[model samples]
Target: MITLATSVFGIVLCKGEIIKTSVHGPTGKISYKDEGFGGMPVVFVHSFGGNVSHWDGIKDSLVQNRRVVRIELRGHGDSEFPKDGDYRISSMAKDLATVVNLLGLQRFVLVGHSMGGSVALQYAGENPSRVAGLVLVDSNGDPKKNPEEIRTQIKNVLFSDAYVETTETYWKQLLERSKPEVQERLFEELVRAPKDMVIKITSELLDYDPTLSLKRYVGPKLAIVTPENDDKFSLHRLQLGFPHKVIQNAGHWLQLDQPEAFREILETFLQRY
Candidate 1:
């Protein structure tokens, strides 16, 4: 049992916190966090260049209403990296499926950000019934068709060498709104990603074409378009042929950039499901 004593910031954190323990994946352990109880479980997946803590800003709020979980994908945060070439979205989807099955959860919501959202989409596409709903935040549908320079600019953010040396404090500093120490601990445990996987994953992200993957996921999906530092929305609109909601004043990392707005938008969307 996990327990957390909290009344700070008017947030009620229950005892037995059930923090992210390791979930065995195909390659290795996939790290994740969990909290709250008595309602449907929801998993929040962070983006590239981000660990699951990115959702902490809004997690406590969500936990008030439902059991909320976040996962650190392979090669990021505390998760183990794949020694082989199994970082593709399909493989990642399988890893997530294993986690869900292990938890014995049924009828839960899947919330994913950026690349993590890509993995969620593919999974829901194939197993729509298993997913109660989906929340795709600042996600990219296709990058290969993007303007070469635009993709290049975002690439800088993804594979920044700064990501390796930068501690959790660095991420918090960069994010400016995150907890100083908790955020740092997550970064400290991240896999020492190899250069090859970085390049390969970049190719996978940019060229994998999540639009094709979306066609397979038939669940209720919400496309959250971040208005800043994100180009995936337009690409998604054009490629996936769906209408999306725009979050004003939000950047690439919308949850971090506009926590309250993100929380409001998320709750509003989830209410319908």
Candidate 2:
């Protein structure tokens, strides 16, 4: 297990070198780290407003026995935001393809958390043979309820003159349960993100409908969700013919709230598939 320290960000990237790779289609660069040597490669895609660091909690353990790849999508982390500002899930999925191709990956397990789950679902649906299985952590393929209030608030913050303040307030609410360091990291990244680009990507995701696409991926899948935060988009609601595991007493950031538990669950699920 390698530990890469970055002077630029003051963050310890575990398992491998922090590599920057260009992902075509979107015409932007993505930051990723690779670790491990054998077994089926396990690739991780983080959520919206997130980066490769999101997997810091479980990545070390995951990489012990299998090749692991974690990507920092465009507009987040060290990745370059697209000049054209194309951050759609489909676009991100294509970017993932670029990563896999660049790394010469064959069949592998795809794991995604939150918005990343949508990208994983889309990718798996389009490239079924390339994906050995899938794991969706605290994710929703198609939200049953439209979060109009959340949308309006985000739009207001993006367009309002008090953009920075309002955005900070909004982010604070989301990261309330995060560790202090994690919260700080997220705030810093969000502040540095191209707001207009982020808004465009988030707006598109809010309207995204992956209902049919998620169901069509006829491959092994494991859904892990926190019971407390599942009301909006519960694992029980996903009829993708997969086992759904519930982690109780946890919030939206399940991995942060219960890292060891989350890691164990994921490792066990991976072993099963």
Candidate 3:
């Protein structure tokens, strides 16, 4: 059963540990669920406007044999909003590093979906020794996409006074194959995320080039994207550089759209280590 912790600022669920930490001199707290099982830990990072809940579909299956960690990035879930308004991907990467150091994690696999994938890559680049492998799920690492145009479009919508309507429409299209309950919860979290923070990080993300980060990661890497996501980020292009796979007949949210297939692919990748 889901438990919630409501505050004047917003609602935060009580599913995990509320880790009070700081990154880049800005103090804040992040909510993280650590399935403290043995074996190598697999850290899972969620997409834009997503919390740890995004991994619910595959969490149990993943945690069965190994340790699994899911974190709710600041401004996105139960985590506290940054008072300094620094929500850069690099900041988020530092937050991950803090968590790793706090838990004393030595070597593990890092998996990230969408924007989280970029954060994972950043973390791996910054701290290459801690990460054993990398799994990027429908991430925003493609250097081909025009950032300026994307940033303008995103800013136009996000900065507008009336963005809920646009967000609702976008959410509808995004969560096509998600279950009704999943759709409701995810939509709420996405909308509940701090608008300014989201806008800032995403805007910075547009200018942030992930090629350097990807190139720096020398360990085993896997890139997974859905057929629907192929247009925005090319699977063929990624495959040319690293091991890339596509989840057939799935959308951007492949974990929710095709959980079984997603798990199978993860299982295959995990076997490599």
Candidate 4:
């Protein structure tokens, strides 16, 4: 049976009786959805400018067997924005820590997509013992990979008066091959996000160094990426030998683009390590 309800606190019960709840983190209220029960819990973090719904396609299948917790970073979705405007990745990871601690998730797998993957990396690296496994989906772990020139170019456009227009264009390019409905949903969410917050987070993401975090978390790790990002110097290629797989013909959002293949790889990883 499935029922949906929203409480005064803004919590919602979605399909499959998933409990959508909120927790007060260091910055503000962080919203998350808790569903299923059993096995090591898998916590999902969405990409920048994205919300909990980004995991809609994959969560249903996993929730049938293991607990699935999808988190909305501060300033995204139903989560309250930080009044102080601290949008750094470290602060974002702290928000994630607050949610997991509230749920009493002692040990579980951490799955992050895009910028969310970076947050998962930061959290897992800091709390190595708490994370049983780490999965980064199309996430970049090395800041150096993003050259200064490229960063400057991106920042110029993001900080310029044409920020919103540029952002929309950028998103459109990424979602070019995606289905019309998928593109529309994501674009709407992106448009609704605060422009300043988006710019700040993107700036922080560009400067984030995942080297120490990657080294700290020695647990089993898997890097699922698309063909365009299967570079020899990528974190998966360099650190997670033989545990990386590139989903063919998929874009940045491979989970949505090639869910079956992505799920198979993830399930295989969970079964093996």
Candidate 5:
């Protein structure tokens, strides 16, 4: 039931009757889907190597009672790649700012997954007054914890001729606990991302210091993660004292792996905060 039309600006889709639109961002056109019209707006930013469709599993339920906006990061989905090859997290955060500004969202809840969590933190840190609440899903807050040797190894692999194969293996390992169908779909999306873009983003991400941003935003915060990440260092472990919930039997993409449970946890946060 998906219909599409071109309007000289970008392709607009009529899936579920939601109007898919685009905004002119710092790097290029940024595509996002806006729906619903009640309650505080809920803005979603998908993970690196993912598009807006990554939120499809839970967006409809949230959209029923709240204005929901899902933004696609540059170089992903319909968004154009940066002409200058700027894939830094801060630049991506600016892309988020562009869309939010265009929508005139003065205040709203921000939700981010994986790399998107970093972008959300950056935005909330810089514009703390605008974000009412912040949620980080399976995202790391201190990538600098990784030793230099490990990062060097990762960079070498990313620049090697076997980059695609190596990344495929890494993605598969992350989805080992997910459903077969979920694994298949997500793997395809992750592996298809432009190699150079992925490399640059990953390289910069290793050096990203989310602590400063996390300290700046003093809003209600929550970290939703899977059991596999329970032992890992994260914002939830910081002195910030924000709560975190671990969904059992779920993989990296907990929202897609356990949509109902993920939504319940998310709704609880929205309600309590």
Candidate 6:
């Protein structure tokens, strides 16, 4: 696996590099990547079990005119994973706020995927004025989506020896099946994540409910749902309370599969806002 490092310049340097930086959260220090500082900062949050590299492809495009930041939330990626606590959505939301404060980011956009998407919603819900805009890509917001059977099944899959054996494929599921450009990077970051973080995050996801969070925010928020699911799921979620657009044919990892379309969506939203 490749170890990402940086010079004194930090993650948001003039050259394309992701510096290893750490910020203090309430519980502990959290690791993250920063790119293109000074302009409006765009903070990125990863899924249930994701590293900062998930946003690599879309980083440069966003960095051209804005500052891009990718945060490895507590218990995920290079961040500190404590052995106890609720690790609730609200707690993670506070962690995001701390990162923003540490970076002196007065206003910015928050884009999150899967679990990160839910965290973004919670953060927006708490601090509506601080958020410039919001983007939720294939995010899970309701606890009802996964029944007890599904949760236990996924928990078993994530913790089993088979998962460790087929870890490559497991991570690849988040990548687009059409484009095969990101193997090296994904392979490196996928295994770097701690297994306990994976399990606990799943546990938290199984109990998360962000409907109230979505309803609380009155800012520019876009939920990019996938078209792979049936019409019923899409209709139910869209009408649940937030406005969203569907990224056709793409699975949960819309950014990796359809970079251009995903970039288009972000640019349009940012421009409109």
Best by TM-score: 5
Model 3 regions more than 4 Å off: 1-26, 147-150, 177-181, 231-240
Task: RMSD for all candidates, in order, please.
Answer: 7.3, 5.1, 5.2, 3.1, 2.6, 4.9
lDDT of 4: 0.84
Off by over 4 Å in 2: 1-25, 147-157, 239-241
- The residue ranges of model 5 lying beyond 4 angstroms of the native Cα positions read 1-18
lDDT of 4 by residue, 32-125 (tens): 9999988889999999888888788888888888899999999888899998999988999999999899789999999999899999999998
Query: Which candidate achieves the best lDDT against the true structure?
Result: 5
Show pairs that collide, candidate 3. Answer: none
Give the Cα error of residue 171 in candidate 3, in Å. Answer: 2.7
RMSD of 2: 5.1
Error of 1 at 144 (Å): 3.8
Model 6 over residues 1-273: C-alpha lDDT tens digits? 234343421232334454567766778767887776555678999876677877888887877777888898887777777545547778888778888887788888899888788889899888888888888887765666658797778778877887676556767665654355555555566677666665666677777777676677778777787765324443226445556777775656778777788888877888854
Q: What does candidate 3's lDDT look like per residue over 116-185, in tens digits?
A: 8889989998888889999999877554476567668876887787677776777777777566766776
Error of 4 at 196 (Å): 0.2
Clash count in backbone of candidate 4: 0
Candidate lDDT (C-alpha), each:
0.70, 0.75, 0.75, 0.84, 0.86, 0.73
Local accuracy of candidate 2 as per-residue lDDT tens digits, 153-185: 766667778877877786777677677776787
Better of 1 and 2 by TM-score: 2
CA displacement after TM-score superposition, residue 224 of candidate 2 (Å)? 2.0
Clashes of each: 11, 0, 0, 0, 0, 3
Question: Arrange candidates by TM-score, highest first: which order?
Answer: 5, 4, 3, 2, 6, 1
Q: Please give, for residues 158-209, the per-residue lDDT of candidate 5 as tens digits.
A: 9999898888888998899998888989988888888888899888888888
lDDT-sorted candidate list, best first: 5, 4, 3, 2, 6, 1
